[model samples]
Target: MHAITPYLLKSYKGRDTEKKESEHFDLSNIKGKDLLELLHKYMQSKSAHVYDFKEEKRVFKFSDIDFDIKRRTVSAFLVAGFYGVRSDIIDKSTGEIRFPKSESDAEVLRHYIQFTVPPGSTETIGLFHKSRGVGIKSLFDKLFKANFLLETQATLQITPYAHTGAVQEWAKGASVKSLKVKGFVPSSDITVNLARLGECNTEFTISPKIKKKGFKASFGPLSDFLTPEASSTQNEIITLLSNQGASVRTVAELNGARRTFEVGANSGGVVCDIPFAEGEDEVELKGGQPEFQSTQKWARSLTNDILKGVYGRRAFQI
Candidate 1:
């Protein structure tokens, strides 16, 4: 089984955040021709996709390029690795070098990529998976920023699709009367009186047994945001967390609703595993082709499943 995550795509015109939010120009009636061309050039190696990683020169390559212009869907595989490490083998017995018999000795990392833009809609979703602690989303961000620019504007952005629906399900008709701080690390900018201690590290729990209390009442709007996926409340929380001058990790149990659940960093979205034959799912790079050659089909199936689960639409076949 393999996990796939979804992200929302947004485009901004300039550096003005307020104006960009007001415009909300996120794939709304986008022709997508220019973007498609850029991707084509990248896959063909006309434009190099290289990055420095741990003092090593790494190159990214895209293969199995499939797209549907009318449906606005693109699917490809991202293979990245260090450039040309081995060419020929050296004979230790005598001073001689010979060419390798096969090219399968080269090591590379791979991940599935899929993007879908609904017909004349503002919503766009890009499905990706992590490869060796790296994500293809970041590569796309750099790709667009370096190549797809519009007079120093038209920036491409990716916002993760949070699992707010799960939170809503747990919060509905349920009162979160307690929040326990597990590990609290103060930011360096802030001064804390540690007395004999050199640093400020604390663990505390705030539990109110009474319903409709102070902490509970003040948290109603955030609960509302989770229920409806409100962007305004989400932005406010983002600002508060970013500028809090401290790193806080909390764990709270949502009771009296459907079921109890935990909310934390990894609780942002759900991870689903796809059921596929092991051999069929694995993409072998023998002669630059897979042993089973079923990765593209697997990608299509997994993408359709995610689309059906998230957007209630399963018309994509590309």
Candidate 2:
């Protein structure tokens, strides 16, 4: 389960007459009592963002929603009577204008219940809404399962000080070629490499193919990997490779393999040449140990493993 933390805020449009009507209702009027009672009754609907209150200006609100992924659950506190959390906005012509960000919406509704409601309000009610709907439930289930629940570690870390000056310089469109590092001893020098992060050496060709049957492979632009189609294709290739005796290994193994192959033939009759490792006595094995003449041995072994059952099979007749 992946967890992504997002910032949440309150929903505040310009204060209007309707707000005042609810804000300063006259207790003397029977309609006010009926209106308050109606509001209390309405706050009973179930949703993650609902809450109940009983005070002198009972601000009826929603509860704090718990988005769960594993059990495919979305338990929300609903403000029974009023749609306090507007999921969608409609223009004057009734066409939807803006849609709420789910996490933000949940946070907004939560803030309203926690901070906006007046203290000492009487008979405030809220509901918890659970869905069996295919679409709505499916979406909530996915967010709860995929985005909110998983543990994610930061793959890259950057300090604020390192980029702050560079960002300021770029914003000003200065022709600054170097960054002056601020903090250090008088005689000690701190050099920051601004170009290293974005610089790409396009002088060499990038090979996308893997020669091993048990290994996975992919191609195309890096951004394409984000799409579902691309992901499916990657998964398919991985499955095929896994079934064919190829497997994903550590970065060290891949790096070693990259250096090992000079010229090789795959089971599909695809021939290619890989670069030779310089100065090393022999190629490094997938296990990270240096093997004497094991490259050719492993290549033959893998090829035999992949072509186990079809050695003598004839080609299809025309």
Candidate 3:
């Protein structure tokens, strides 16, 4: 499985009272208590946890949470609660869609979150599924509020650590002249002006059907182009290409020469590989079994990767 590894950084401040100003507390400054234990208690309570998005309530549950005292680490899987789904089958002869109700209609999905708490450290690494909706930070914000667990008034933020070697190398290029987009399907019309004003530019517009198969384009260096249009600037064009699972390969002008670079696929988060052991078979689960053991294992493996500095120092640190 492909995963993204980001950092989870926490800071706490005391509630403001009339007598004194609110006091800030770093993870290192907290006295004699493990913050992860707060998470454990909340999960153990088995309260119904749901996230409101787009005016619809989606259920979520902390399926598996494990803390290792000796290693100072926490690993957990948050699963989307089971929802009923009806399977649709296309009739080859009649070209009609048929819906069938069966026990297989029950479906669930899970996302991963894991982090390590080193002694006296304020920042730790985190791993998250690459879904653009309802991100890791939002999930944590809903879970941990000021006094959600009485006396645990802590604020947490998860920010993308984008300063990696790959990104730095991309930035070092003199100017970007070309890019390729992948893994994106247009939900609506998308228009990209491939050149600036006063230049012979191709205004590339795509429909949902046409964009299903991704495309690549090239032009002169952006520096040589004229003023950007009101609708789309050079930066805007690049940002549009980078979003929604699109990776970019650019032809760049560097040191009076041109070179190709792969970049920005991980600008949202660092890409990690979750490979299974050779010759190890996957186990399929039935009723009364954990639905997301693979996800749980992947989260634990990513936490171990953080301790090994597999993603580089600055790339995983907050």
Tell me, by TM-score, which candidate is best: 3
Estimate, for each residue in 158-203, the C-alpha lDDT of model 1 and write its tens digit: 7776544323333344444443343355545553555344556554
Q: Which candidate's lDDT is highest?
A: 1
RMSD of each: 13.2, 28.7, 12.2
Which regions of candidate 2 fall more than 4 Å away from where they truly are? 1-292, 312-318
Cα lDDT of model 1 overall?
0.48
- Cα lDDT computed for each candidate against the true fold: 0.48, 0.24, 0.47
For model 3, residues 1-318, the per-residue Cα lDDT tens digits are 233445655565665787576454555445545665655666555435643322223456665677666666666666653334456666767868865544334234555666666656666556665332333445555555543435454465555543232233324334665554545544432323322322231222222223334642335343322223435555466556667434544455545544333344343235322222212213223342323565455445445435444344443321
Candidate 3 clash pair list:
none
Tally clashing residue pairs in candidate 2: 44
lDDT of 2 by residue, 32-141 (tens): 23322222233334343434322211123434433322322122333222223446554645676655533223322111111011122221111111111101222222
For each candidate, what TM-score against the reference? Answer: 0.47, 0.15, 0.48
RMSD of 1: 13.2
270: Cα error in model 1, Å: 9.6
| Candidate 1: segments with Cα more than 4 A from true spot | 13-21, 26-38, 45-56, 82-106, 132-134, 150-152, 163-293, 305-318
